[model samples]
Target: MVLLVPRYDEPRLLAAEMELIDQSFGIAMLGCALAGFILALGLSIGGGHPGAFPWAVALAAACALGHFGRRAIAERLSEARAGLYARGMTALLTVIGGLWGLAAWLYMDVHSPATVICILSLIAGMSAAALAVFSPCLPVAVGFFVPAIVPVWAVFIATGDSAYLAMFLGAPLYLAVLMVFARNYARVARHAIALRFANVELIARLREQTARAESAQHEAEEANRAKSVFLASAGHDLRQPLHALGLFVVTLGRSELSDKQRQLLAHIEAAAGAAREMLNTLLDFSKVDAGVITPQPRAFRLQPMLYKLENEFAPQADARGLFYRTRDTTTTVFADPNLVELILRNLIANAIRYTNQGGVLVACRQRRGCAVLEVWDTGVGIPITQRRAIFREFHQLGNPERDQRKGLGLGLAIVEGLARTISTRVLLNSRPGRGSVFRFALPLTSQAAQPADASAGTPGTMPSRPSLHGLRVLVLDDDPEIRTAMTALLQSWQSVCVAVESESEALAALADFTPDLLLADYRLRGERTGQEAMEAIRERLGRVIPTVIITGDTAPDRLRNVHAGGAALLHKPVVAQHLHTAMTALLSESGWRPEIPRAAGMRMHG
Candidate 1:
């Protein structure tokens, strides 16, 4: 059972109770002293005991002075030493109680019943007041009331009269009752103090818990930032060597070789391609994880995007000896075009990679006010149990051997991420030993118009060797291997190439060589960037040259910087054909006409 009254065993709680009693003691003492003086003055004038009046006044004055002195001492002491102050006050109250009892004894007379009654009443009142004032400390209350009432009882019993004897016995009983009441009151007060302290402790614990939670949140944020930094640094470093290797491979492909040498080179290229795919997949996953891939939703016809995918994957399907088909639709989709394209590209690529015998089909249909775009592939379908697992990173169906040719299994993961980013749901329908269908719904928009033809302009056909005859190309890159490989590639295309490693070198080269194009690396030696170099060179040349910034860094900030620079950006380990296409497009847009001329020598400076 819970006790309504608790023990005052806690030192802090005891101190608190003592301090409360101390604060109120002065007022209570003053009230008692004034009452004593008034009773003494009235008794002296009425009963003709003028000598007792002086004694009573002196006792009352002493009591007031003692209380004030205790208060002064209490003010100088800290709460931690309140026990000492409590003891001193208890002794003082005991003395005051004794003095009150003495006055009662001295003033009581056999001749005057009124004086006896008056003195007895004053003593009883003082005893009752002690119970109220000293109840917080039980021992102090006992000390006070015992001394205050005992002497009065003694004088009455000594008279040996029947009435006085009865009064004497009743006085001890009354004192005993008041003492019990004081002890009970003290118990209840201590219980309240205990609860107050408990609440304080509970509040303290809550503050500590809140502080710990905030600290943990801060640590998690710091770890996430560190992870982003590590990924950016690792991606940049990895891409640099891979970028140089790709350039060397392209240069080697341009040389004469036997059938065996050609086959070996093909193997090398395939291995490099697999590595590049894995790297790109990791980069995409990081971007999604970092929340950098934001959707740019717009209304556009779906047929053109489907046609683009069909044309892009046509060559791969033909190489694999599988038919590829796309059903044209006039449906319009309201979603981010680029994010939708990324999702579709991954789904289509996965379909092509897994299918061996049958074809892949890209189609769209209407469903409940939305366009359901789907990719159907006749391949080794996923089992029901493993369907949900396919969209997880590094999860693939029947590729346990970890074959690079089968892919790193990040395609479906990317597809799911991109789909979620655009607030679209990707659904799968598959059965073992049959085919599979991957589909997502896009909200239909009535604002888009149907085109005259549903064709993504024919996929650009990169020439076996692009002709840059009589054109001058300026190349800036910090890496010597990249510079040399680019110079060889451009020179092979019949262009006069000027390769330099720094901004100062490129500026020096530009004094004699006015190039038609500028291909610079995004990150160069020291703090200078390719964008800065391009702007500086253009300003010095007094004309805007078509520029392409090649970057190995997949960091979001660097990518955004390159994009904002208003120049075409090519990521590291760029395919030779893609680079050629970018150069040709820029040159054509600038109205640079290729002139049939003599072969130009490659110039390397700085």
Candidate 2:
């Protein structure tokens, strides 16, 4: 069989084999010295040769030089010269083999069987040990094995004895078997070294990939944060003008006009209303995502909120040629009334928007000691694959072109978010062609709830115009257009109004007017906010005046700050009706009234 000589071109593998051989230098020297001294002693005892001691000393000195010199060579070995080192080690082992062969030649002439057996056995053992230590390089093993055995074979054949001749014939077969073993062992050693290198390379690649994944995740988090910041900044800026426009619209609606002019006005109002609705949708999503919506749960009858939503959406459903229906249940559930209403409003609106033919249904039933509220619709039903995806923000079905008329696609996402704040989740059940049902569960309360007041009004509903006639009001805002719009809108209500652009102007105006109510923007031109301005005004007045803090900011911290200041908080783009309601409620809470008529005491200051 051909010998397994690992390629010397692979510097790393060659260096690894060299290291393995270098480690065995001490053992190799010891074995050589012991064998040489023992053979010399055997020769002195058998033939009493005078040169035997000197010969042993020379062999020992050669072995000592070989060990130290190999170490010196190893210290100077570099990657480029590794092959040279391997060749030098092989030559050194061959020379050591020659020394052992000389021992055989010198001892066998004595013809002592004991001496001959001792030398032969020692050489056999040394050759076997060389295979173990030097098998990584096949050439080194072959170089040592041939020289040590060939001399013994020559000596045996030179004898005419039958026994020596037989041994001589068998010696070549023995050397061939050991060469086979050495070749197989060298193949295994090289395979193991290559495998170790492969494992190290794989580990390095794995670490690199892990670091890349971590970097990607960090980048995604930063991008999401940037998106939130952009929305907050943009929302506040955009809503400032939108808020002013709504106020102007309300003031304009109070003016007299012809039928055609009224119709055009109606169209203008509708377009403005649609824009306001979209902005409101964005605001709701931002509030939910910012975790600013805290649920205030209480025991309230669910019927009133349901009834209010029905009145709000029934006309839209009728306009679309679809039936609107609700089943009344006296199920008084414990939950945040406003959050529950918001959730139902989104569901009902989504149902009306998507359904074309069949009617939509809102119903409630008690299940497992909880009130389970459900909204059923005959819309294009959600598929199983898309059921979870529909709850993701901006995800929608059947509106790939993103038709704004179908809504901003945040209805269900808002619904889900609001439900979670109340310690629950919105669940969905749908079939492809039939319909879908959206539902959530709320705890059933044993306490008796108050009856639903049919006349109770929600925001956006026109309440019996709470007469603002002859009411003294103070408005502080930094925007010029907002100050103008507020002045005009409040004057149209026949309220004595004074609007200013800063805290100094507001404090200045206070000297001439004892305000009955305070209306201020949350953000102002200077360091003082509207809330702070109101507080400053209240401090100057020496009593808490009725206050409403209007804001266009949707950042969580901003909302929390406004809420904590103990003033009625109103978001921007407030509907005129809602603004009127809030002002009336605050005034009434402070026990103020219009003791004078509008024509007699009405005053306006810009």
Candidate 3:
């Protein structure tokens, strides 16, 4: 007889079952094999009883082989959900194993000898039932009733003898014990089935929740994109009329009209400008939120721009009964111009807006090689409790007698984004109803600053204007009035102006014209934007023209495209001086320095 041994991996493979029925089946097979081996060894002390040994050997071999085969069948059939086949195979093999055990008991004639074998079979079946945990209730009924009736009927078959009677009497007790064990096993299986169903339901619910969450996330992204689109379309549509209105307003300002009428016109222009500013802010915020506005770092004079802000805002503060000032020595910094403008505009605007009956002081000084710019105010301060919360969108606080509609509550938020662009930040210091201070440091330039302002101890500075005298200018816009206005404005500064409407018109003009500058509107006809149009123009010009994208579109994506075009950007209702300033600054490398001061020729009020 072969002494078969199970491998460790056998248990590993079978252990996939949650209830481990395979484990129970393996243990039963092992028990049967052990009993058979004992039977073979016990029947023959030496070579005296060869026939007995052979009989025992056959039984032992059958038990071991049947056990191994049965377990294999169960494992294969379990995956197929072939419950009936598994039950039949288990019962047939288990009966054989029990017979082998019974023969061993009979050979030895141990008192109540069949009891051990019967108990062994019972234990195997019960263990299997217990581990199965979730079998149908009908199967549990069949397994218990069939086995329980077996010994009871056997005792009745030999009822004549007194010993037989005793066995028959004890049969009912054994049947009762099996009934109890089966009921308990069934209960466990039922409970396990309940838990399994519960788990399945939970997983289904979890999947549904995850799907909804993903759908909501997609919707949020779409909404943000829609917002950007709406802003762009609205801004573009309004710009044509706004540009016309702007020209008319300027003309009206020059009319021999009443003081109140002039003031009314100024108010109209101011309101329009403020609306335009809000639109731009929204556009920038959208681009930033969409992760398209990247910092375009370049070397520029920080002090000059800072000083310009101080001078620009001082009159406004004075009109509001508030003082405006700044302090800075270092001027040069390598950073994005657009981002710097965004930050400084918001910070200074806030200082002036918030300060009442007090002064706003903006100061900058050289720290190491970097410049530290600070804005201090003795204005109505931020509450200590709400200092952190103030940065949130649309959040505003109430003072003793609060102004209902103040700023858009996006000042500090814009400041945060602008600071990130330049790698310079706004640092805040404030006490409720006392004052607040906002400061940020900037990197210094390698070139030494001119000596006049080093020891002068002043931050307010008049902007140093550059000459743009013989600068060749090309302006492309769809509107006839805007093109005429641009041409008139540029020619007055001794700059040649060739204004066109479309790509075809521009090409025709280019045939006779070799201009030094190309200023184009971002949106042109025939599904072409300024970026593409300028690219074609640049190719024809055989040089990267100092191009500027002038547009009124406030869409995040459109603005992003303009920024990526590597051109200086200007948003409309364009003032002639602002246009000239942008053009001169960009075209100054061509050595076409204009002698006349363009700002001197224009008039404006804060």
Candidate 4:
């Protein structure tokens, strides 16, 4: 077997060099301060003025300050920037110090070589400390050369007047001391330079990381805003088409039509139903994710929604030849309506989906004095082992592939999500291939869930086709058909709606653009989008206006952009009920009922 030896990598080399640099500077600074203190103490004791000692102390203090300051300055620059200045400062300090030493030696005839060497060392240390006051790199060069030069100069001057034999003897000792200091200073200087480079690089990286984090935060906020706008806009667009379909459904139900036509209408109604579910789900998911689905405590009817659920699921259960029934007829509950209905819808759908022969039973019971709804189905029951894991996202039991007949595995997940929002819990009791019982507990309220009551709960039914008799609205879209239908709907609601083809057309109407509300499509004919149109119109109107973006695509990215553009987004296949409610709400007369609560784990069975 061959053994492979790992070599020192570049980062390790750089780090080692930097560590050497900082440690060397720190040691040198501290050592010089001690040496200066001792020398100045000796001088003052030996008849030198004590005033000079304070100056020595000051030098020590200044050196200490410079030491810290160098670290700080090195951190402030990017690595490349720090390295550039470091190289320049290092050269400058060494060259200047050497010249100054030469000049000093020429001018002074000092006899006490030790004192002279000490003073020169102090001067070099001081210079090293000061050079880096502005540029940290200078100290690196000062550390290496200063220790060698001052002592050599002292030894030469000391022996200048002495014998040649004495000069030869002192020269070797001087060289030895010079080499020690030289090596120490050299290592220190190299490490310091490397450290500065690393520190600068680290600082640059940190700054870059900070910038990226800030950008991501900004995008997330914008996405949330866009979601809000989308919910408002989507509710409106989907509602308009749904409302039209509802009217047509009502009309078709009353007409003397053939059995085949009735079946066709049923299919239309089912498609309409699926579309509406998607719209609601989009809003629900956004609200939950955005932390906007705050649960409000209010006493409202729960029985009405339940009774409607019974009627709604009755046909489906009958078609499946399964018995679907509920036990309790209790009503009032103090909980979020929007959330409760969502739970109920999931449980019912789940029960109906898997029931092969037996019927599903829906019942409400008073448990621990709290109203709890239970949906029991004679369907393919969940296994005990799989029950705990079922509530997770995309978890499906006994299903090989996610087929079209079965919806996404969000039913129970959503149920769980919504239930948690209202302090509710979903419980499941089942055996594989036997049957299942999904029950959720919730709080009760004062209002009865009856259609006869005017203010028991959020209105379960769609908004009535009331007169928009004297209202004014602006419809902007590049597509002609969309413009025409929107105008027709607004006109039928008794509002004056102007159909425009582009941002220019809308801008052309800016002189008279203040038409209560502005509706624009996301994609315009030219290089313009609805956001641009809304902004231009708002500027002309001289105030922030309420605007909605009607779009055919509901892609997350496009929705995110819509948020950036600061406009409400609405997906296509607009229904009248949702549109009217959203429009009315935007206009400050919101009448749309929030969702009702059901089982928390209802979404888990998806």
Q: What is the C-alpha lDDT of each candidate?
A: 0.80, 0.82, 0.62, 0.61
Could you tell me the TM-score of candidate 2? 0.79
Please identify model 4 stretches exceeding 4 Å from their true place.
1-269, 275-283, 290-292, 446-463, 522-535, 543-571, 585-606
* lDDT tens per residue, model 4, 49-94: 4655665566577557645656655542343344543444344444
Which residue pairs clash in candidate 2? none
Worst 10 residues of 4 by lDDT: 597-606
Error of 3 at 268 (Å): 3.8
Off by over 4 Å in 2: 3-202, 314-328, 352-359, 383-385, 398-400, 432-435, 451-455, 458-460, 465-470, 535-546, 588-594, 598-606
RMSD of 4: 15.1
Ten-residue region with minimum lDDT total, candidate 1: 1-10
TM-score for each model: 0.71, 0.79, 0.60, 0.51
Rank order by lDDT, top first? 2, 1, 3, 4
Q: Write the per-residue lDDT of candidate 3 for residues 1-606, one digit (tens) a residue.
A: 111111111222222232344435556456545655554554444323345556556655665664566545544534344444445544544455345434433342324445434443543454344324312232423343444345444545444556556555655555455455545554565566567668888998999988989999999789867766876787677776666566566556545889889889879978867765666666566666556667876667666676667667888888898877667554666567557766777878887788777898777777787777777888889977887787765466653344534666777877887677666667788987788988888776656542222112233222454555556667788877777666655555556667788877786777877767888888888878888888898888888888888888777667677888888888776654566668877766655555454442221111
Candidate 3, lDDT over the whole model = 0.62
Candidate 2 to native Cα RMSD, angstroms: 4.8
Candidate 3 lands at a TM-score of 0.60
CA displacement after TM-score superposition, residue 519 of candidate 3 (Å): 2.6
**Model 1 TM:** 0.71
